[model samples]
Target: MDFTAILGAWIAVGLTLFILSFLYRDNPLFKIAENLYIGIAIGYIFSITIYNVWIPKIYQPVSNRVFTSLSNWVPWVSKFVTPAGDAGSLTPLFPAIIGISLLTRIFPKISWISRYGFAFIVGYGAGLAIPATVATMFIAQIEGTIQPVFKLASGGAIDLSGPALWTSFSAILLCLGVIVTLFYFFFSLEHGKISKKVTKIGIYFLMVYFGAAFGTTVMGRFALLYGRFFDLYTYRTSGYYHATPILILLVLIFFFVYFGKSRKTSP
Candidate 1:
């Protein structure tokens, strides 16, 4: 590979080793890698937000508004103004004002101004999200749980030996799970012997759900670890000039020398 490509490969290998070193112990190498990753991620996200959101929605619309106004007085400026179809009018500037108000929190005396911006954001977000949440999480879930039972009952005759039996069984189990889980959260009524048993079933269902979710999350993290390991293995080849082996050797030597010196210097 070219020199630049080889250099990039070496840097990637070194950084990967630095991050992996954390499994042994937290040290300067791991901290350096962690901070570098965070800084780069923030810089990338900021650039993306600026280009994708701020420029298109805020800057362009506001600039077009100013240009359109100026063009009325100077005919030559009309050429700089974008088409009316793309101009979002001055509506975008209202949010831009609220966004700027958020920055006022940096000042001590005027920090209270930021509350208005925060209130608008919270109110607007809730207004948009609450209906969607209820529709999807509450209503849709109820519909899904009930729809299957309705279909199973409406079918002329029950077939215990066919897929219909399996479908009906699953639908009944799901309905029972939903009812018991909801009852488990119903604190108004005192839970008696029968109620306790129902709630115990709910507890089992919840535990299974939470365990499955946690397992899926762990598997995703391991997948990322595997990918990084694969890259580390690839860099061991001659095409990357054995960057992985050289870095690993350097890391081992550094650990031994540093710890050895520390032991001698200790009281």
Candidate 2:
């Protein structure tokens, strides 16, 4: 394999080992890995924002279009007397201006200037989130819960109407159960006799639902762990010296560090 590909594979193995450390116990090694991951992610986001948002949306558009346009000349003069269009076509000055405005919060003299950008960002984010929550999340969940349970026949010979009715009735009950259960936690007032009874029934259904969800989550995690173990076993069988030795060493190191930390912390 090429050096780059080999390096990438090694990094992937290291990351997997770091994540597996959590199965043993929390320690300095896991904390370092987690913090490094967060730092790298933040740096990546900053780089992307500089390239995508600052350059294309704010800088380029403002420098190329807004400067040369005759309509903006009067307002531009009134705002600031500095000559426009002197900077290059893709000048970084506009981004610098906005960045300065954003940094105003660090200085007491111009803290109020940062509020403009913050308000714009907050308003736009809220506007986008509301529609997405309603259309994608809320409606999709309702559709999933209310879906027909029966399978259709190819020849159109058999009637599936009864199964559909049963499915609808079950869905209605499930919806009511969830709603009542949610309402049970909504208030401090003492629940009346009927409310108490309904809430008690709701709790039973909720517990069943939660138990199923927990089972599914556990199964998914176990499946991932099994896959990793399978990879290690397969590599060993194939006589891959690097993968087998590294996997063994990683497990041993993780266990040692985890147990060492646990011993130190335990009373």
Question: What CA RMSD would candidate 1 show?
Answer: 3.2
> Compared to the true structure, candidate 2 yields what TM-score?
0.61
Give the per-residue lDDT of model 1 (tens digit) for 102-142. 99999989999999999999999999999999999999989
- How accurate locally is residue 92 in candidate 2, as Cα lDDT from 0 to 100? 56
**Model 1 segments beyond 4 Å from truth?**
2-4, 71-89, 150-155
Q: For all the candidates, what are their Cα RMSDs to the real structure?
A: 3.2, 7.8
What candidate 2 gets wrong by more than 4 Å, as runs, is 22-32, 62-102, 131-162, 185-189, 226-241, 250-267
Each model's lDDT: 0.87, 0.70
| Model 2 agreement with the true structure over 93-172: per-residue lDDT tens digits | 64466556878899998899988877766788899999999988889877776655444567754446787667767767
How many clashes would you count in candidate 2? 0
Model 2 whole-model lDDT (C-alpha atoms)? 0.70
Question: Model 2: clashing residue pairs?
Answer: none
